[model samples]
Target: MAFQCQRDCYMQEFVTTVVSCCPSELKLENNGKKEKVKGFNVILKDTILFPEGGGQPDDRGTIAGVPVLRVTRQGAEAVHFVSSPLEVGLEVQLKVDWDRRFDHMQQHSGQHLITAMADSMFSYKTTSWELGRQRSTIELDTGTAKPGEIEALERAVNEKIREHVPVTVKVLTLDDPAMEQVRSRGLPEDAVGPIRVIDIEGVDANMCCGTHVSNLSHLQVIKILGIEKGKKNKINLIFLAGNRVLKYAEKSYTIERALTALLKTGADDHVEAVDKVQKSVKALQKSNLSLLRDMAVLIAQNYKNNPNRGNLFCLHRKEGDNEFMNIIANEIGTEETVLFLTVGEEKGAGLFLLVGPEEIVEKMGPRVAELLEGKGAGKKGRFQGKASRMERRGEVEALLQEHSRCPHLEE
Candidate 1:
């Protein structure tokens, strides 16, 4: 609040008149954090500030050359808060930063164009919209889309952006019922007085409180990211326009440049580089498997004898990456008649099999599993079990040697 303007008597065009009157020599309040501009916040005053309401961000810029950090409506008054201390009653020239303002207008107006296009082309009504820095989104009341239909809608919208339609902003108070014709009756629940409508000229007309450009020409471009389903009958659309498009393009260019150099491929040839990675992965898998096969043969050669035909048992346990050890165990199991336990990283995790003669494997395997604190559920005339701890390795070896002493373990 300006020191000169009383809470009750601040005129409607108060901010413009008062700010112009104050000189830079006026004293500031609160040292700096919050500064009061003499002629700020009055209705109808042409000051550069985005008002806060309707989920839209507050307009930001300098007033009197001092940055107006934010703008909010106190009752009907638009209060402009400036960073640092502002000279009270100081005369300061007001300027609106067009570049930033233009970008916001582009996205906001683009939304109107989209909503209008959707209503006209597909009988869809927009329920809500969000204007973000990188993207904008619109929620519509109906959605049952196929890929082809989506593509067609996308193409239609881009065509409209290229066409460059006209958008108009209209401000109306609640007292005037004529304002009703300007937009729908969906006045916000929080609307204390007038309803501001952003009409896309002859295009879309709706009651919106957010700041928008005066014309659609300012938008310049639009890009749709995707459509997401909202409730049962609604869908949300994600898009970008103007500055957002340029920001996305700049980021994309950076990534493409880095990838081109790293992968040694032209922009169009990135796919070939990706395919090369897949081929390399496949080759590595084959080479690794061959190594496992050779290790299996060495383990098989260590087995003492083939009991009931080709059945053989060899217990070799170690610690490492669980998958690697499991693969080595699998290789050893495949080579011998009845390859037994080859425990690895997962100590309690071991291999079990029964291979040689069907009867011998079926009968002794279960008994061996019971004794070894493991399972031989699968039979190949071999049974594998895990030792509880590293110290249990000796116990397992002793048990294997004792297999000769035990009648059932012999098969």
Candidate 2:
């Protein structure tokens, strides 16, 4: 939406004259497509809703009791996006979303104080910042900062907040002497006429075009959450301000209480409790594995003593594994026998078929899986594969019996 703002905006409630209600163009976000949405951009002579700019989000509320979807700045005008059109030259009452507006003020003001202190105290210059929904971040021109340094900076910021210093905005011309005192990365190329500078009493003065609270006390408090390493050797300091600090504290306390109850240990002992439980689980797994190995050996001996079903020995055990089958095959030694083993009949099935004379097993292994509508791989005298057709286990046993009689036929 394109429009021009003749008067300065930033009033909580204001009466404005509607200049025009025209079809506005909006670029769709986050689809990598150059698409636009149709909406009415209501231009006002003056407005309270701040347009999105300077790392801050747009203010949303009602304009003439109609919900304003978004506000954008094209040149000097504040354009309000709404569903329906308003009559040109109609007078409308613009009400800014106070809760959202106040929250942004707290965070934006807190950032200025923190950035100023970071530069004055530690010589760390702020490169950029982001005003997020839950928290805010200021990127400093440094690789990293130590815990002590951050703690000290937080303390200094809170001290300024308690001081309740007046936050003032001043519009100065390009050649004004106050511009020399402004702390900024640089001015934009298209920056013309007067410049808006947010001055935090005696602490900071920076060229910015964002809304801020009237005083530092409105910030309530500033807490440094942590720091992240950003691109190009910069450090991003994560923080919360005003109501966000209260919300964060409430959530942290709730999480700590829940952890204590679940672990059956106090906050200080929770880590130790978790470590002890992990060790016990590891010991139990080791004991279970040894028992399975012993059981496999005894099962192998039973089959070795009695060559069941003539020369075709077949065993159908539920949930047996390839490891158990391999152990049984080794225990039987080098004998002239064929073993057809199957496991997991109810859900699915797996087969381990071994035939004497390694060459016969290698050639017949893949064929056994094919007969069961599955796939297999083998070498030496053992072959293992999965059979999706569990009902075909009986057919596999029958094939082994028929092959046993024609052993010389395969050779």
Best by TM-score: 2
lDDT by residue for model 1 over 1-411, one digit each (tens)? Answer: 221111211121224422322122212457555555443332324444556665466666565566665566655456665544555555455455556656666777677777778878888777788877678889988766665765677677777656666555555676777565664637545456556666666667777665565555566667787899887788998888878888899998999999899899898998899899889999998887676656655655454334443333545545223344444445545442443454454345544433434555566566556655664464444344443343344454355446534636543
Off by over 4 Å in 2: 1-10, 25-37, 189-192, 274-411
* Residue-wise C-alpha lDDT for candidate 2, range 1-411, written one tens digit per residue: 211111233366777799989987767565777667777988888778888877788888888899888887767677889978898888998887888988888888888899999999999998889999899999999998866999999999999999999988887777898789988777656555678888899999988877888889989999999898898889899999999999999998898899899988898997898899889999987776677678779977886677452566767667467776777677765557777777667546556555455866776787778877788777777777888776777777777777778876752
TM-score of each: 0.55, 0.66
**Model 1: residues >4 Å from true position, as ranges?**
1-46, 162-164, 173-185, 190-193, 230-233, 275-411
For model 1, what is the alpha-carbon lDDT of residue 335?
41
Pairs of residues clashing in candidate 2: 4-77, 5-76, 5-77
TM-score of 2: 0.66
